[model samples]
Target: MKQTTCRIRCVNALVLAGVIATTLAACSADPGATPTTEPTTAESTSPIDRFLTPTESVPPTAYPSATNSEQVANNVVSWYESGGEEQITGVRDRSKEIYSHHAEDNWSIDFSLFFDRSKEAQEYPPIPDRKTQAAWSTALKHVRSGASDIYMSNQLGIVRGSKEVKREAHGWKELAQGVKGLKAIEARLHREFGLDPLTSP
Candidate 1:
């Protein structure tokens, strides 16, 4: 009877241990179903779940188109006739006012005017090569002619002054003296055969 009681107790303990091991194995197997494995890893409380994230593409910005010379000339001429040149020339006239304040007095103004004149000339288109035989020969003349009204006025003044100077200064004695000097000029000097500077005044 003692041997039977001891055997029953041992059997009961072994059965209880087997049941506990089985429960632990089930908890480890299904982590979602059991709190033990679930708490081992952090919970993702995000409102929505994602697997592969979507990518976005950004487009480059484009710049504005530039105005061509023909359009620029048309616009500039229209603006000038509407009193733009008068306004610009008024500002340019005040160049003298700011000249002294600059680092290199007078130098910058001269260079600035030179640049402005060059820039203004390119504002108009060139005459087509097929236009005429004299196109190449007279291109500069047309450019000078088409320049703003103020430049044309200055060119006219220059021509008028040159004519007046030639008329007042030329004489037979002056002509003969210029010719004699041209003949006598030293070959080594490479001096040009041109008008005598003294006779001009």
Candidate 2:
């Protein structure tokens, strides 16, 4: 009986890991893929609330579809690059559609210096500084995925922050200065994680 229980437990753990690996893999397909959302007017139909509050936590057994989350994030990024943040509350179109999509899963985004979903998480780690943010490749759960400074910079194409920005020398510029898209990221975060795809703003 004891041997059976141990076997079952190990099997269960492996199954769980496989499920997560599958979800993450599916989401990560075609990293360079473009947004599927058709372009529309930049006007936003999203209420201010979606960006402000955290999404209701799902049960641990309720795994998220990384693919869908990735799509939503991609659409929002397209909208943002075209100035979606500046064009809030206007005629509705592609921007509005994508924005609406994002609001549906705002947690998947990382707002960086713009929002504070970090405080909203039920089980989150302490806020990390610039150095730490750049190092962590895994997405943050409580905040969705869009809260880190380095994470968003990579999404916006300002810096090559595809992963951790490593260094310890003196001549390095401040994180804010190096990443021009940072302020835009932060402000939009004020507007909005998953997977820009890690969350800290």
Against the hidden true structure, what lDDT does model 2 obtain?
A: 0.35
State the lDDT at 103 in candidate 2. Answer: 26
Give the alpha-carbon lDDT of every model.
0.35, 0.35
TM-score of 2: 0.18
Question: For candidate 2, lDDT tens digit of each residue in 1-201?
Answer: 999999999999999999999888877796866666775444343444345436332223222333564554554444433333232211112112222333253424323322332222223322122222232212222122222332343344344432434321111222223222333334443444321322332
Candidate 1 C-alpha lDDT tens digits along 97-160: 2223334422222334523543443343331212221332242233222222223223333654
Best by TM-score: 1
TM-scores of the candidates in the order shown:
0.20, 0.18
Prediction 1 global C-alpha lDDT: 0.35
